[model samples]
Target: MCDLMPAAQPAEKIGKMKKLRRTLSESFSRIGDCQGSDSLIKPLDTIPEDRKVQRTQSGFDPFEKPAGQVKRVHSENNACINAKSSSSGKESPKLRRHSSPSSPTSPKFGKADSYEKLEKLGEGSYATVYKGKSKVNGKLVALKVIRLQEEEGTPFTAIREASLLKGLKHTNIVLLHDIIHTKETLTLVFEYVHTDLCQYMDKHPGGLHPDNVRLFLFQLLRGLSYTHQRYILHRDLKPQNLLISDTGELKLADFGLARAKSVPSHTYSNEVVTLWYRPPDVLLGSTDYSTCLDMWGVGCIFVEMIQGVAAFPGMKDIQDQLERIFLVLGTPSEETWPGVHSLPHFKPDRFTVYSPKKLRQAWNKLGYVDHAEELASRFLQCFPKNRLSAQAALHHEYFSHLPPRLWELPDMSSIFTVPSIKLQPESGDSIQVCSKSKATSNSKH
Candidate 1:
C-alpha cells in the first residue's frame, strides 16, 4: 500500500505541471496579438522627448507644406503630439510638430502706429488715403486703409505693391514704410507728401511757373529712368498719381496696376492707363508694350502743363480717343508706321487722313520755345519703338539747358530749390478750401 502511494504522488506532480504549462501557453499567444497595440496601452506622455521630435519622412518644405498633412517638427522637449486620424489604415496616425521662433512663419519687423488724421488725402475704389502722423516717431505719413473682401482676403494689388516696394529703393518712387495687417483691413503706411500734382495744380489757379514745369519734367524723367531700369511699368502715370513734396521732390505713386514687364511669350492688358494719357500703341490694342508706353503720357503731360487742360480729352469711347490722337499727330499708315496696319485695333476705314499739327505749335502758341515742342515730339512718336526712352529723354537737348532756348522763360535751377509752401488754413476760407479738397478723391475725379 505504501509503494502504491509514492507512485501516485509522482503522477499528481506531472498533472500539476501540465495544467501550469497550458496557462502559460495561452498568455504567450495573447502577447503575440499586442504588437501594434503598444500605443493603445502606453500613454503618449511616456514617450521619450527625442522620439516625439523626430524628423518627418514626408518630403516637403516646411513653409510650403499643405494643410492636413502631418508636418513633423522637432518640438522643444515637449510630449508627443499625435495628429488626429480621420481614418487610420494599416499604418497608425502620423505625428506633427511646429516652429519655435526660428521658423520661417515667424513675425517680421515693421514700424506702424496710431496717427492723427490731419486731412484726407485721397480715396479710390479699394482704399482711402489720409495725411497722418506717427504716434511713436512723430513722422508724417500717408495712411492708406484698404477695404478687405472675403473671396480674396487681401487683394493681389496690395500684395504686389508691398513686394515690389520692398525691393525698390529710389528717391523718385513713393516710399512704402510699413504694411499693417488688421482683422478687417490692410493699412499701407507711406511717407507723407503735402499734395499730389493735381492738387498742386488746383492750388495754382493759372499754372505752374515755366521754370517749375521744366524742373518737374526733368524730375519725372529722372524717376521714370530709374523705374525703367528695374523693368517695372507704372501703367498709370496721370498727374493725380504724381506726389510732390513741399520742397519740390516729385515721386511716382499709385502703383496698383504696375507690373514687372512680361516675358516675350505673354502680353499685358492695354486698358490700364487713363485714356488721355494712354499711348497710341496701347489705344490701338498693342499688348506687347515696353517702357516707351509711359513716354506717351509724358508728352501729354508736357502739353497739359503748357495749356492747363488735357491735351487729348477723348469724349466717349476708344474711337474718340484715337480720333483725338490722330487729330494732333496725324492718321497712321504703312508709310508713317511700318506695322501700323497689323495692330489689333487697326482698321483702315475707321481712320481719316488728318494732317498733323506741329508739336512746337503748343509751345509757340503759348509763348514758349521750340525745344519744348522738340521734347514733346520725341515722346509722342506714333510707333512705340521710335519713342524716346526715359534715360534718353533725360539726356535730350530740352534738359541740356534752362527753358526757352526758344528764349523767354525763367531759370530752371531757381525753381528746383523752391520749398514746399503750404497755406495755413485760415479762419474760414482756407478751411473751406481744404475741406473741399478733402471731400474724397472721387469728387475730384
Candidate 2:
C-alpha cells in the first residue's frame, strides 16, 4: 500500500507514520458491506481421487514432462520432492525411500533407519511433516509422513507432490530433499524452512512494512511466473504455503493440492484452494481454468499483505465466500465476464444484479496509489482471462519504478534505507538468491 521510506529526520518519520495510520483507519471504515449468510460446512480443497492412470506401454508417464532449464525424474513410478538444486544430483541427498512393493515404480528396497525424526512441524488430512536430520550428511530436512489408508494405495495428492516436485526446480519453491519409504509408511524429505509466511506475519503482527511487502510480493510473482511457464498450477497459494527462510527469502511450498495443466482441456476441480484465496471463477463453477486460477490467488495474497487480514475470509460455504468477494468487488455479470453464464454451475437465480465498483476507490480509501492501485486492478479482474499473468506482473510498472537497493539486500537494511548502494536498473546487477545450505538450518532466521 504505502511506501515505507526511511526519511532522514525524526519529524519526517513521524509524519509518515501518521499518514499510514490514518490511511488504514479510513480504508477499513470506507468499505461498503454486502450482507452475508451463515454457513460452516464446505470443502476448501479437493478430495483425492483414486487417480486412475492411463499408463502407456512405453512406460511414458503423463506427469513427467519437465520443461525449462533442467528437469529430473527421481523415478518413473516414485516421483519425489527435492530442493531444485538438489534435483541436479549435486545437492540431492543419498537415501532410500519406502515404497509399495507391488508398484512398478518401486526402486530396490532401501532402509528408513538413515534419518532421525526430531519434532513434528504440522499435520494435514493426507500427511504430517516432521523436522528430521539425515545421518548420511547431517543435513536437516522436513520429513512429510503420509498416512497410508487401507482402501487407497497412496493418495494421488502425495504422488503429485513427489513426482511434480522432482521434475521442477526453482529458487522460490520448496526443495525436496529425500523420499524415505518404509513398509508401513512413506516419508517425503524436503529442504526445511524455519517458518511459513503466515507464521512470519504473525511474528510481525499489524502487518509488515510496505518495503518488505513489495519484496515478498515480487518474489511470489517471480515464483508463480516460473510455475505458470512450466504449465503447472499451484492451485493453492495462501500464506501458509509460502515459505520464508532466516535470510528473508520466500519459497512456494505444499504441492499436495497442486496439479499439472493439460492441453485441449483445463477442467480439474472446483474445490482446490483454501476458501479465502479461492478465485471467483472457481467459486462460480468454471472448471475450464488456467494460470488465472493462481493470479486470482496472488491478488488475495496481495490484499492480505497490505491489510493484514484476509480479503475474503469465507468460513466454509461457497456462497459465503462469494458473498465476501462480491460484497467488495461487486457481483459479476455476463456483460462483465463473457461466457460466464456458460459455466456448469452458473444459474440464472444464483446472482442478483449488482453494479461494479472500482478497486481504486478502495485503494484511494486506503491512501495507496500508483503500483498498488495498478497491480490491484490487474490482479482483481473479475474475468479470469483478464487477470495479469505472473510473468507480466513481475515486470509491471509498480516493480519497475523501484530503486535498485530495495531488492538486493537479504533483508531491507533499515526503514527502506540502503547504505552505500547505488546501481542502475540497467547495471545488470541482480540479487534474487536462496541459501540452500542454510535453508534447512534453524539458526535464528
Candidate 3:
C-alpha cells in the first residue's frame, strides 16, 4: 500500500503519474463539499409555487451565547501546524504564524521540499488535497495545497482554519502535522486518514452495525464537546467532513468554515453550512444563534447513520430544505419558538402547519434501538435553544451501556485506548457483498 510501483524507474514513474492523474480525474471533485455515495432516498417533492417562501437579503446571521472572553494562551507541551489570531471578529481575517517545539515524533516546520506528493485525493474551490509522504520523518500525510489568488493574498477561510486548528489538539479532531508555505501555494500537512464517514457508509449501506454506530456517534460528540467548550463552532458537520481511520477512529476535519465564538454579539454569515445539513432556524432567516447551530446537523447525521439514508435530502433550494424538515419536525409557531414572527423570512401564511412527528416515525431504525429516539429528539428540536449541548448529550442514557472509564480519558486520548472498546463488524456485510457482485456482473456486459 505504501509504494504504487515496485521500484522507482523513469518509465514506471511516468506510468504511475499518468495512472494517478487518471484516478484523480475520477476522484472526489469538491474538497470542501466532498462527494460520496448517492443519497439513499428520492429527491424531496418540491413545494407548491403558491406557497414558495420569499428569499431574504440579510447579510449574515447572529449567535448570541454569553461566554467568557477569549485569552491568549501559549503551550510548550506541543507545537501545532501554523497561524495564530487573537481577534475573533467576524469580518477581519488576520493571523500570525506561531511556532513551538513539537512532540519528538512530529517535525517542527516543513518547507516545500520536505514532502513528496504521491497522488491527488480531492480538489475543492480553494485547495487540492494530495496523498503525500513526509521526506523528513517518512510518514504519510495529507497535503492541502491552497492556491493563492492575485487579488487576495491569503484566503480568509484558510487563515481562520489555520488559526482555529492551531489551538485545537484533541484525539477526535484531525491533527495538523506541519505547514509548508511557498510563494504560490500554502500547503497544510495533516495526518492522513484512510476514509471519511460518507465513504464508509457507502461501503456498508442499509444502516451500520448498532455497536459501530454507537462508537462513531460517541466519538463525534466527544469531538464536538471539546470544541464547544472552547467556544469554537464547527459550522459544517456533514459526514464528508468527518474523517474515519482504518482503526475506526473518527476525527473532525475541514475547519474552513469553523469559527471561534468569542464575541457573542457578532453576527456570522448565514450561508455557512451545507444546505442539506443546515439547521431550520438558520433556514428561517434567524441569524442570531448559539452552539445549537451545530446540534441540528448532529441529529440529521444520527438519523442518517441509523436509517442508511439522509433524514431530509432536499433537492432544491432553502425553502425545499425547510419543507422537508417541517414535514417531519412540524412547522414552528410563536408557541413553539418565541420571536418566530420577528425572523427575516418567517411567513406564517405561506406554510401549512402540521404537528411534530416523533423521531421514530421518521427514522424507523431509532425504534429498534433502546433510548436512541429520545436522544435524537433532544438534538432535533425546532427551536434553536432547545437542542441539547454536546457535553450534556454525552452522559445521556443512550451511552450508559458504554464503559464508565470512557469519561475519564484525556482530551488527546481516544476512547479505543480503553480495553474492549473497538468497532464491531458492520451488520451490512452481506448486502455489501451482494452489491459488489451485482456491479461486477453488470460490468461484464
Leading candidate by TM-score: 3
Taking all chains together, the TM-score of candidate 2 against the true structure is: 0.66
Q: Provide the lowest-lDDT 10-residue window in model 3.
A: 70-79
User: How well is each residue in 173-204 modelled by candidate 2, as lDDT tens digits?
Assistant: 77665554433355666666666666555445
Which one is best on lDDT? 3
lDDT of each model, Cα atoms only? 0.55, 0.55, 0.64
Against the correct fold, how does model 1 do in TM-score?
0.65
Candidate 1, residues 246-328: lDDT per residue as tens digits?
A: 65667778776676533231346776677668888888888877777788888888777665566776645678778878887
Clash numbers, per candidate: 2, 12, 5
- Candidate 3 lDDT by residue in tens digits, 1-445: 0001012345654565455444322221211211122122222122332232111111122221111111001000011111211011121111112233355544333445545666555455556666655555555666677776656656656666766776788999987665555545666667767667765775677888888889999999999999988777888887767877767888898887786654332355676676667898888876676678888889889988888877886655667778888998999888998888888888988787888898788889999998999999999988888889898999999999999999999998889889889988876533223233322221100
Tell me the spans in candidate 1 whose CA falls farther than 4 Å from its real position: 1-113, 262-265, 362-367, 402-444
Candidate 3 residue runs with Cα over 4 Å from true position: 1-108, 263-266, 429-445
Supply candidate 3's per-residue lDDT for 67: 13
Alpha-carbon RMSD to native, per candidate: 28.7, 20.6, 16.8
Question: Whose TM-score is higher: candidate 1's or candidate 3's?
Answer: 3
The better candidate by lDDT, 1 or 3, is 3
Residue 3 CA error for candidate 2 (Å)?
30
